[model samples]
Target: MRNTRSVRTHEPSFHQSALMDLRRGGKFAAVFLVLVFGAMGLFLVAALVIAKQSIPDRPAIASPPAEGVGSAPPSGSAAAATGQDHRREQLVRFLTAAAHPGQPAWRTWMPAKADTSSAFVYTPLSPADPGAREAGPGATARVRPSALTPAQTASMLEAVTRRGSVRPSSVAVSHASGRASGWTLDFVVRTSGGNWLEGRAAGSDRASGETVLSQLTYRR
Candidate 1:
């Protein structure tokens, strides 16, 4: 009987030990789950911070202020200066066309409001000493067909045809004057040939200037 009693007591102790081990395992599993979730939360927070840092700041656009409440109008002199600039630009276009004979119809070089009736006063340079002649009085003569001739066009392209030929290097208004009749401009066209063509342009109206090719002169 004593032996049987001892066996029962040992069996109950064994069962109690098993239950203790299972409780310890459950506690360990709960701790492991808590650690994994904490690491994931930290990783997610770091990713959000990195994303914010990677984004670039955009530049702010500037908007123009509304006109007229306190804005001052352009001065009279400024307006006149603008008009002169426009006339000079037109003269430069003509000089450029005169230098390169190809593209942009030769006649388009003339001002929109040119007076064709008024003949161009062209003066040819003496062939003997083409570069020696000066701008002199009585050197000019009125020609009926004011349009540029084939020979003149060839001469305009001379710089383009010579050694190291390039299109017109530069065009500038050498002289300009406003008169009762209209505005007169003298343009200097420099070419790749290292030579320049002197052209004279005149406008029909003085108030609202409208210039045209009145003269074209150059050295051979």
Candidate 2:
């Protein structure tokens, strides 16, 4: 029998025909270019959105003792005026509540913090002297919560803060051994860069001329 080559099938599946054509470069290049551009566009859009979100939107809160308090106003600045007013209000609120009502009628002046002000009132209600112990040998002399001799209070205040107030917000009551008692306040209050100060009370023993122990030095 004469052998004959089997007739090959002419019809190919749609996928097979498509795969055979992939060897051609133009279509594949076009598809790859489209995909590349689309990815790049997405990346660019994402970067733009991120760039817009990185900025801050609000002003910062100012600190206490900001410039422009208790001083002459600058010629034409709204910002300075606002700062000055705020500082004044803070000082008034703080100092008014801290007024003294004793006999000597002493008050705080030249607060180490130029941004703030303080005042006080007093009564000779101290059960005992607070500074006697700390003022003892080797201890620094300071105003006591008990009836303070004005001279003693002044001396201690000068030693600590280099300022003086006839009245203070709190009192210093310590034991004879330098320990505070019954809400004993630290009368030897100092500034961050200044010495401690001793303050006087409001009232006084008229005959003794000594200030009654009502108020003393402290931070709170």
Candidate 3:
């Protein structure tokens, strides 16, 4: 009798089959999750890029101007004119004060070094009293026949007592001819005696560089 080898068929058990199915299902779930998350990340990146390109650029802002940039100082001629106007105004005030009644007022306008030898000539334009004889154009009165100082002139003027007040009007000032720093003024004043007085005054600088009255004459 020939020896017959028994051929046994090997088969997997139920537990092993169940374990293999579980492992295959787990791998399929992991692959699906990875694909979904990767697609979502790509979509987010594309959306950000498109948004950046659609936005408009902002405009630049300008700065303010510096201090004192637009304004300029006065020119030389303008400054000179302003100085001349101021000097003229000062002279007017001085003339007004000099004609006023009191000795104190006269001193306020007179400079400290005023010429002691200054001359004052007066011509009558109208008589103090209507009945009195009117002086002719050529006739004049030298209030101070001798060379009198400003103080002496003021005292002499004060001595001629008059009833009404004195005030200046129709004043005109001009630059002296051929003299750079000289000025001449012409003015009319209503005297304390109810008569009109016309006056001319010229100013010059002294040796000590001080401006003082060189000539002062009046017509009444």
Candidate 4:
């Protein structure tokens, strides 16, 4: 063979190196995509846990009041009793202030103060005489307050809620000038029960002329 040189059928070293570098680059891209997605998933899980911990918990509300509502009395001494206990329950159990009223029906009354040490007095709706009972049958008893403390007066006033179909027609409290003491409180408790049952109570400390005026008007 006359001097014909066989051409080298081989790539340059630089070209071969470039081909190897391309292959490695493809693997690196795939691994980079996986690592990027995995980092995003971890960040999302961390965010969810932080949000869950941010919320605060609270307690529940209380239920409603009872039917008769035996709460603390506002004036004198609050008492708790049912409406049906008018006749049977001792009226004395409800006595509080000065006197239960009796009268020609005054329109207003001033009740005793929260600070006074005055004694409570009882004034029956009807007379203690048996004749008074004879006039009204089933109206067997009328026990007003004979004596009462502050709480006792509140108890008596609470009794107004008793009796069938009872409603407070008008309840008023007032105080007036007394001869000896500073003032006298008059509680004018007027109620309706198919008829009017008006009871009154007055009270005084060491003051004379302090008493309640009670009046009950029954209409047939």
| Backbone atom clashes (below 3 Å) for every candidate | 0, 27, 1, 30
- TM-score of candidate 2 to 2 decimals: 0.27
lDDT of each: 0.56, 0.39, 0.52, 0.39
Candidate 3 stretches with Cα past 4 Å from truth are: 1-84, 99-101, 108-166, 174-180, 187-198, 205-211
Lowest summed lDDT window (length 10), candidate 1:
126-135
Global Cα lDDT for candidate 1: 0.56
Q: lDDT rank, highest first? A: 1, 3, 4, 2
Q: Write the per-residue lDDT of candidate 1 for residues 25-77, one digit (tens) a residue.
A: 99999999999999999999999999999999898887777876447867877
Better of 1 and 4 by lDDT: 1
Instruction: Give the TM-score comparing model 3 with the true structure, all chains together.
Output: 0.35
Tens digit per residue, CA lDDT, model 3, 45-114: 9999999999988877767768886577778776556545544454455556555545455443344444
The superposed Cα distance between candidate 3 and the true structure at residue 156, in angstroms, equals: 4.5
Quick one: best lDDT, which candidate?
Answer: 1
lDDT of 4 at 83: 15
Candidate 4 residues 1-220, lDDT tens each? Answer: 6898889887669988999999999999999999999999999999999998987766677778788675655442221112112211222222322133232111122334442433233322344322234446434323333334444333334333343234433443332334222323333444343444444332222324223233232322
Give me candidate 1's TM-score against the actual structure. Answer: 0.42
